[model samples]
Target: MEIKNEYLRDLYRRVEKRDPNEPEFLQAVGEVLQSLAPVADRRPDLIDWGVFERIVEPERMITFRVSWVDDQGKVQVNRGYRVQYNSAIGPYKGGLRLHPSVNASIIKFLGFEQTFKNSLTGLPMGGAKGGSDFDPKGKSDMEIMRFCQSFMTELYRHIGEDTDVPAGDIGVGAREIGYLFGQYKRIRNTFTGVLTGKGLTYGGSLARTEATGYGLLYFLREMLQKMKHEPVAGKTAVISGSGNVAIYACEKSQQLGMKVVAMSDSAGYVYDEKGIDLAVVKQIKEVERGRIKAYAERVPGAVYTEGCKGIWTIPCDVALPCATQNELDLAGAEALVAHGVMAVCEGANMPTTPDAAEFFQKNGVLFAPGKASNAGGVSVSGLEMSQNSMRYSWTFEEVDRKLEEIMKGIFHAAYTAAEEYGCSGDLIAGANIAGFLKVAESMKAQGIAY
Candidate 1:
């Protein structure tokens, strides 16, 4: 990525040299820095204040070893990490992903992206990400419980409601959250909002499970109205992933009169000619914890295909890559462009690669980056934090309405920022600039750390 501003170019080069092996982190840095050239040119004092340089580096990175005993009395070990990227506006807020793929680079990438995503929500939440390489799949409840206890044993020392709050991601969900929260409570001896995505019986807020998916649609609806004066009604949509984000995204899109034709899991994708049956999907995924192929078996007129990436090859008016980062590559973007995709809004962090995102923008696809489009989860997490502070919880309708309003506010913030920066309709740039400026201003106000 070429940054036009001389200062930003130098900073990018320095980051590249410092972390050459971290492709994901470098990719995120490149995207944000490239979009920031315009801001850098206008506010050269940012360079003088070392905001760009400092923001790229995490405030703290903690790595630890997690060891636990399995059901067979076998010892299992995994690595855990938390990258507290930034806390200028507020305490660190992000998700904890547990999977075999967890590593320093991936956590850094996620943490870096979370900084801007939290910022775009217009809430006083900073950014951080923590996770372990412990795979929770196929583990017995007691095994998972023991692992969560061991992981939290070291992690509890670094987190708090006001300092840093970690929620679920990837392999981490409500079940895992229950175990982790139980252990945290046992060790800390007090209940606080140290974690989001808790059970409703506890400090958890309503609408959190549906926040990201519903938030994505809310942002997309706003984008559609602004660009085409339309809604998602009667349109065909393709979404990747069968997790919480994809499942609820299907529900919300269906409720809005859109036909979601396909959804996927890691192993494969299931395509239905008619709109997907949300009830059946919920039963298979949420209830049975089965793979997506089971959806094809249970529902008629649906075909199961190997390889989840093939989901993108199916044509649609809209595409939501709710899966992992870089899932939608340049080829996928080209296919979507070829299929006349009107818009693409990400429901996952950095789901679209840089090349693909630029292709969509150049071809006038009304693209929205994850930072702006997927801030709803964190927005409501912030709401959960607020509720935790007040010892009160809002109703589902109330939280959902607040999330919709915040998504609209984020869209306008990014959109207006893009227009101001002379990059109208380029939400990728708009979001980066909007989020960067807020953090930059805060960093400036705080003065140099050292």
Candidate 2:
């Protein structure tokens, strides 16, 4: 979309000129600015306050060196980063990702998107993200622990329960969180809710593991019911990635009577005519840490494809991209549209590319942006924060109920905001506008420095 608003155009140009090399961050900023053009026409005060300018830049960007020893007694080094993007509404809250692809651009993009995701949850939390490029795939437990300890040695001083809280993402899971938390505790000599996604024995909340995946279906259900008056049951769905998000999303889709016929991972995808066997997938991904292709070998009459992107070619009524950023491109969107897919809801952060998302919208497919659909993980993180502060925990049913309500509220907020802003049925605009307005108002109320 072209930026017709002069104020937004100029602000975007400044961002482009300042961060010429950060394409991911530039893309995120451009997408949000495009959606806010309508708001800029009505709210001139935001331009005067320089909210857009400040919002695009991180409040604090920290980089440090993490050095650890391997089992071979060899010294290894890695880079760590924490981008405290915005805290206008509350303290910085986001996840700590660990992947070889981690960098300044990706971290900034995730952090920028997170500000809105946290806001859409109607929770008192800001947006921040931290991670390292350390690959935990083949590392032994002790090796991973050493890396986490080294990473936390520098990170502990900058985080706190009331200041900034970090959780797990991508490569950072329960084991990684435990190691990082242990280091933080040993260094600070105090236990607090500085981290979420902790073990059940610690500060983690019930239903936290399944929050993002389950929350996604809730949002999709509301969108389907409200927009088309269609029920989710009996619908065929395809989900990508066999990680935590995809696994639980499949589980919820099956529970809702939707047939999840296909699922994928980095290696490949498996298509089962009889619908996916969740137990087998869990055994392969969670228990054995095996490849997705193994699902085909175990399940009768299942076909396995070599490439992950080919999973989109399969026909389905609903398509959920639960994979990483930009996993679904224009071609995938076109294929889904040609197959008569009704809705596409994101389960990962920015899983759909700009053109693909636009294509889905143009083709009458209900599209839900990641900032809205994937906010479930952070929503539960916020709940975990509350539980930790209260020194109490909610039952799984209680937490799941709250999660369902939060997801529905997010859907309605986006739906209503889009309609109000003359972009009815365009959830991208609605979600961006609703989430941005809340943060922008809070920023304006707190003054320019905030």
Candidate 3:
């Protein structure tokens, strides 16, 4: 372990050269480097891609050649990845994503972000991310099953109930989890809780489906209740991405008496003047498994647009970007401010760009960064781990209550850390600094690993 600032620069250079234009990767790495600088100074020996950087990268980023037989028996070979990024805090825990955008850089970036996010939750879960380049939208069920089996064949060796637990992400859901879990059981010769997001008949948590969305609103409630600032009820809200996170955000917000004006997918967004109908939207998304275009058809008088960027243009007091990384840009931030947006809580990881985040802070918006807001999903996953170990089940209300308390505590921790660091009103810095401090302190106390 050598503490050389130049080594970090070299690591950044290598990543940048490989990615070239991945702003998200660069931004995430930059934040990590910033957080680790103090640690590097204190333990200069742990520098230069030492245990820290290597752990920051991945213990093993297994990219295997997955060839599966489709329904027609035509063999399809897709690149699959599982970034066992960091296991210092606990076993590797993250999600499996499947989309055209899946790649090593993206997976690594997400895994890196998850390390701190998991740590901040006070959960004994490390961070990892796995996914494939296969899109499940057009794939037949048989084809998806084959692909999942193929994926689990390689993923089984590196994961276990006490080792690593992967969950659902953008493209992987109930069906995919079932397939993967089945494969894991067949390969491991045991029925264990090696994965979260399992079917209810299995070891999955009850409220895991609605965890992220509900947890986000719970965090927002705490953020709003600070100093009795503002209530989400009666507030106009906009959410991006018509997937699980977006749909659930709408459901919870409506329950809290908010006017959700719009929700969107990659194709576009649907905006209704008189608050979005949660049941219809959920049917269109969670049930029908369709795009937001169908949303306008189901709900009369609602308009759907093709480009998702314009989603932020609609006026709202609150905006929840549950879509993807960097979905809300600087212009979107300005638009939200212009429309009198009071708060922006992220239900997705790194949904706001650095510039957009800075713009919101400069304009006085209550911005709960993704790390604090979207932690509900993983926090509950940790709870599921407990239930699995104890061989007991908790009521949905009980799990939801624990989620609410954790979200509130995370929000408060970040807020108080900001206050202590004299970084008032700047949540991005507060969150990044606070989240990293806990992990960094733990890493240092553990001493260097050979």
Candidate 4:
């Protein structure tokens, strides 16, 4: 793994030395750095200004303690963090994941990725990510509310509508967002649109829940049509994760005349050769708040498997990893390629390992990275910000249409950028180059600042 640019290599070495134990952060920085060779060759002024060095470091990193009482009348403590990674383009924008895996490295990686993801939307947004090591599962509503309040009590000081806006992620959904927003309002005494995933009655945008999944399919469809001279119709798709992204991706796939054969959760994956029943899955995972095992038990033709990773082995024409970071490794990519997968699109941030992504590319799989493919969530979040600012809402069709257009724009921008850089079909480099150039230019215009 040798870097081509001497200055870029030096910057990366500094990052590695400064955060040796932060593998997630290192991996993210390494990937972005690897793609900057084209930019470095074209923009030597950026190198002279040390843009790479400054971009790798966050504008601010805030960490605080969150202490709440559970239903058992015991005081529980958790750590919370928010990494305001970069704000060259606009205010910091990203999600907050309230999982036990929340850490500095993970938050930094997500924020670093968000910087580009937000830029790709062509919207005025920077990058930031925050979360606590708090697990909302098995907690009562009141318990969750108390925890959200505690988390927001310290977080409110660091965020605002025009400053840094945080939205929902893994464990942070509508329920948590409502709680956090209420707490922020209570503390700040302001009803500004500080959060995007609010209930529709309170300024949330429509089609947000389905944005990431639907957006993923839109981007994938365009890629398939351009590269393979076909649409998703009649393709058997294997998707990981049964959450909002996967469910909506499945819905969009079915609507596009494609059949989704598999979807998974943390416990395991379910495979149905006749295409997944999105209705049954929604009822189980959303309404019933149950694991995917219930889906297998209730669905007529679905088979349940034991582990999440094995979902990749299910034969399909397309594969969507919407589960979590690094969920799909070389083995999973190899399995999909071996099964003749035509395309691999990421619905989760950094879901596919670098090697896996390269493997898919080398094998002629039309691979779309999460930043470009699964950007619908934040793209709609940006729209939600607009609706909130205008104090108006758009119809579902309106927002969905706008989302489709944005995804298409993102694809062409990345596709063309890759082709321009003489790496046609290499969306990994294309997306990185496209997004990096946008933020880099913005940073340059703003002048160098510590």
Candidate 5:
């Protein structure tokens, strides 16, 4: 997309020049900048204040080394990163991803998107993201613990309940969060809600586990009703990924009267002509810690493919890419469109490539971006933050109700913003503009020091 506004164009140019090698971060920035031309035209004073320039730059970038001993008693070293992208709204809040693919570019991209995502939630949380290049696969429990301890040794100094509260993402799950929190407590000698996604015995919120998946459907429901004048009932859906997000998303889709026919993991995908059996999926993924291909073996008449991306070829009314970034490319979008997909709501961060998302919107498919739809997980994280501060937790029903309301509010906010800015029904533009306005205005109000 071309930046029609010269000021926004120059800002993007500077970002490109400074981070020439950071494609992911540059793509994120460019997407937001492409949507802000209307805002730039309306608010010339923001341009004068250099808000766009400052927003593109991180407030702080911390990198450290993590050393731990493996089961063989040999030492291993990995690089860790935390990019505190923005704190204009409130404290830095995002997840700590642990994957072999982790790097400065991925962290920065996630953090930049987090800033807007947090804003869309209408929470006081700002944006930040951190993670390590350490791959937790094939490691023993004790080895994972040692790695977590060493990672926190350096990270404990930079994070707190009010400073930055890190949650779980990707490879960082309940087990990882438990390990990370334990190390933080041992090092600090004090227990606080410095981290979300803790175990239920601790301060973790009741509905936090199901928040993202449920929230995606909540947002999708609103988008369908408001844009297409249709309900989610009777819609056949295909969701990519069989992890936490995908599993819960499948559960929620079933609850809402939709048939989720297919799900995938890194190795391959499983397709069931009938609605997916959630119990079997949970057992295979959560309990067994096995590949998705196992799903086909356990469930009779189901077929398993050997490639993850092939999952997109299935026909469905709704498509939720709950996997990783860029998992759904232009080809996937074309396949979905050809199959007459009505909506594409992201369950993972930037799961749909820009071209794929563009194709969806251009084809009159109702597309909800991850920042708005996937805000559910973080919405519950924000709720968990509140519960931690008060030393109180809400019931499962209460938390679920709150999450539904927040998702609905996010949809309307983006919808209204798009209509108000003359890009009616363009949720991509609406979400970017709405989220950017809040943070941009907050930055302008606080001056350039932030």
Candidate 6:
């Protein structure tokens, strides 16, 4: 599993010298470089055509000021950004994350991951991600509306149905998408499908919210079956990030007979020895918009820890890191392995760092990287694009079924690729190799764009 990507190494050096502060960007490059190991070992055309270098850097990364007035009449300025990573296959498509951690590095990592995640879904969508540093929590609807409107005012000119289509991520949800899409419509005066995660009344697709989480479980199920691992029945699992991905992953895992004992947010984590109460979690996160600490009050015997770390140390057979990027570092991963975690699936993109990923692989743990495991969200996003293009929407069951199938197919692709590359059990390598091959072939076929 040696990576011969000399070009990737060179690009990494240049970018490292330029942006030393952007760990997310470096992590994204590292994951891609890990994937390109097999490709670089096998392909000279890719090296000669500069495919390794060009794809490492985004096609365009736009930053702007999102200036809006709060309810207190104070002018609040937050930075907004969009990274169009690649589009050799189709229009740019990814989610918009509005966490306070929003920056060029985070967005670039998400967008870079999106490139292959979308490609792995067998969809014709490229990768892009945008977000603002504006925190939606504790903000009134009016203030949030003004912020979305301002963000979209400039972003509208760069995106459309035929161009880049964005969806909701960490801090952005149906509410944010509704506001952003409303502004787009008001400005463009066209009822086109410019965004995927819109409200149902405004042409949004069903099952989109459950796509990523459920898709993660589906992929994990396939992995378990292929590897002849134990069924999820009676398994204890820990999930971080009580957002859409964590909640849905909790739901599907519960249905599949896994007990999710822990879930977390940026502020902290909640652990219920009897498995998380999905209803309570949804109420706190989805409706009340409260922190993870609130779950302790409603659920008996549940305790809330004031940090995202060590939530992984609670001893679980399955560990799903649905939190933000690199939330599961080497220490956390070592803890999970020490606790005898048999399976680790990423429900969040790049949630595990390279060192952690290598630790899991080296320790013989079944690892599903974000590119392969958490791709359900963008795969459903691609489904939304299809429904929009055809002027129709599918039923929830239909969409869910398609999502499960897609996730399973992606799992098989990685599984098969791993076997072919002689890294049969190294799914991290398999996924990176599989996803990179898809974009690489497309990049080569498209030839030099300049």
TM-score per candidate, chains pooled: 0.99, 0.99, 0.93, 0.99, 0.99, 0.96
| Pairs in clash, predicted candidate 3 | none
Candidate 3 runs further than 4 Å off:
1-23, 34-55
For candidate 2, write residues 338-403 as lDDT tens digits: 999999999999999999999999899999999999899999999999999999999999999999
Off by over 4 Å in 6: 1-7
**Candidate 4 to truth, TM:** 0.99
lDDT of 5 at 422: 89
Candidate 1 regions with alpha-carbon error over 4 angstroms: none
Q: Which runs of model 4 end up more than 4 angstroms from their true locations?
A: none
TM-score of 1: 0.99
Task: Report residue 342 deviation for candidate 5 (angstroms).
Answer: 0.4
Model 5 accuracy (lDDT, Cα):
0.94
For candidate 2, which ten residues in a row score worst on lDDT?
Answer: 441-450
lDDT winner between 2 and 4, please give it: 2
Residue-wise C-alpha lDDT for candidate 4, range 173-234, written one tens digit per residue: 89999999999999988889999899998889999999999999999999999888986888
Alpha-carbon lDDT, every model: 0.93, 0.95, 0.83, 0.93, 0.94, 0.88
TM-score of 3: 0.93
TM-score of 5: 0.99
**Model 5 lDDT tens row, 254-370:** 999999999999988999998899999999989989898888999999999999877888999999999999999999999999999999999999999999999998999999999
Clashing pairs in 5: none
RMSD of each: 0.9, 0.8, 3.2, 0.9, 0.8, 1.6
The clash tally of candidate 6 reads: 0
Q: Clash pairs of candidate 2?
A: none
Separate clash counts for every candidate: 0, 0, 0, 0, 0, 0
lDDT of 3 by residue, 1-450 (tens): 122456666767776676677666678877556434444555555563364555445667889888899888789999998888777778889999999888888988898888878888988788888899988988888889999999889889888988889999989999999999999998778988888988788888889999999999999988988934778788899999888888888889999998899999888999999888888887878887878798788788999888999999999989999999989999999989998899999999898987798788788888988878999889988998899888888999999999989898888888876676656666665676667666656665677657
